[model samples]
Target: MSDDLPLTAEDVAEIAAILEHSGFRELDLSTRRFRLRVAKGDGAQDGLTQEWQWAGASGEIAADVAGVQADPAAICSPLPGTFYRSPQPGAPPFVNAGDTVGEETVIGIIETMKLMNPVHAGRSGTIAEIFITDGTLVTKGQALVRLA
Candidate 1:
């Protein structure tokens, strides 16, 4: 773990797991070769903690809702990560553009750092549009579904 050495995948995973197990919310480590950061959040599941924001080859790690407007009735990603429209592969999507959802309905899951973060519809409405494809990467505040 020297500043002059690049961290391997195992190294990063180990660090993240350790920090997560310790109930830490954030981690910042740097070396002459690379700089690494890990973020934690209390996900929508409530009480199930340890959601890390790590941007591997994606270049920039961001997890704040900002800078983008699709529709007044859009549901945005609460965090940055891979957006999965279904709970698992080859499964039906949680919702489609014309589907209706309730305030607490889960429209999708955002996968970050091996954690599945559920994205909910904050308001009850019919989805007017779907802005993202299944398994695509989504950024915080980037609208994924638009309400009618």
Candidate 2:
């Protein structure tokens, strides 16, 4: 199976139930041609539950504690496509290191199928780092910026 394979809500619910019963905070399943990882809880006071499912040929999954401050900054791809920072041929970037960003700020753009999608800062933070350079491909849930 591949990531392109269609999945249904029933599949998700069944997987969630399995995880809930097993007392495994995380679960990853993979076959010869497909793989996926599902995790529960965001480790915040509200404890938001988030699950990530990816299907592809040959994949791996591991379990980790939630809310562990592994990285202060996080980069997220607004959309799935190629990510570009520079405006045109040899233009300065919209943002650089040591820059502060508002919650509604436009950080970058992801080009998908000839359309430019604007990326924003999900939360207020500083541009601690840039993970990708100009004209780099990005996938969904892929980190793009790190917050301070």
Candidate 3:
């Protein structure tokens, strides 16, 4: 939650509205000031517990119209490393929300053992969300981005 893009209650509602038919099973976004988790109503069908956590808040949608919250494909880290969302500081991020990426698209970098390794999209789809910010410490298999 940057002051530049303040997350509001309306934004939460809007995100929930978007979740209704976004073809995504679940959507998770967290920032300094906002943490949101939206899941489909019948999430238990997948055998995943519908536990939720966000800034001391939790919820589940009971509406059948929005109960199909399935998880979108996530680009995860392969090794523990420093995650960089851009090639370098003062540079544009490799990808942003709504950006289309291919299986071979380089979305970011993971620096391990002082080596910067490029991270690929691993799948072809629009980048619906990004989880890690620039220069964060990411662990192996941590969800980095959500693809639709």
Candidate 4:
């Protein structure tokens, strides 16, 4: 009998806690013009449920505008692994702020399960920023660079 009612804040909080402990990445809820989503891992999108009938096409347009795009400054990983910006321990990093990089330039290395995978620049541009630090874990599609 109670299943038809909307969820309370306490219920949502408990669900979030459970999702966090279970290693799930996301959860979503939607009703008419209202929608909610929670991401437990790295704050990336994990789930989505939409009530399309209430908002119509305008909501879809808004969602499309908010989507992320691939850019030249985007330094995608060569493989899934730990990312290191330097060539060796205690050495200066290969690139720094404002350094110009070509498409073939190696920006970092990704260590996957004992194998070293070299990461490269996808396009030529000035190094606007570095997103990850040395010895940090990285996943596929994670941004590692910003270009001018």
Q: How close is each model in CA RMSD to the real structure?
A: 8.1, 9.5, 13.2, 11.9
Task: Flag clash pairs in model 1.
Answer: 3-32
Q: After superposition, which runs of candidate 3 have C-alpha atoms over 4 Å from their true positions?
A: 1-72
lDDT (10s digit) by residue, model 1, range 1-148: 7655655543454455455446667787765545667655557422112222333444554423233555677888766678999999999999987888999999999876787888889999999989899989775568998899
Alpha-carbon TM-score of each model against the true structure: 0.63, 0.51, 0.52, 0.52
State how far residue 41 of model 4 sits from its true place (Å).
24
Tell me how far the alpha carbon of residue 10 in candidate 3 is from the true structure, in angstroms, after superposition. Answer: 39
- What's the TM for model 4? 0.52
After superposition, the stretches of candidate 2 with alpha carbons farther than 4 Å from their true spots are 1-72
Model 3 per-residue lDDT tens digits across residues 44-67: 443122223334455543322222
lDDT of each: 0.69, 0.62, 0.68, 0.62
Q: Which ten residues in a row have the lowest lDDT in candidate 1?
A: 45-54
Q: Which of candidates 2 and 3 is the stronger one according to TM-score?
A: 3
Q: Name the regions of candidate 4 deviating beyond 4 angstroms.
A: 1-72
Tens-place lDDT per residue, model 2, 3-42, is 4565544354445434543567877666543555666665
Among the numbered candidates, top TM-score falls to: 1
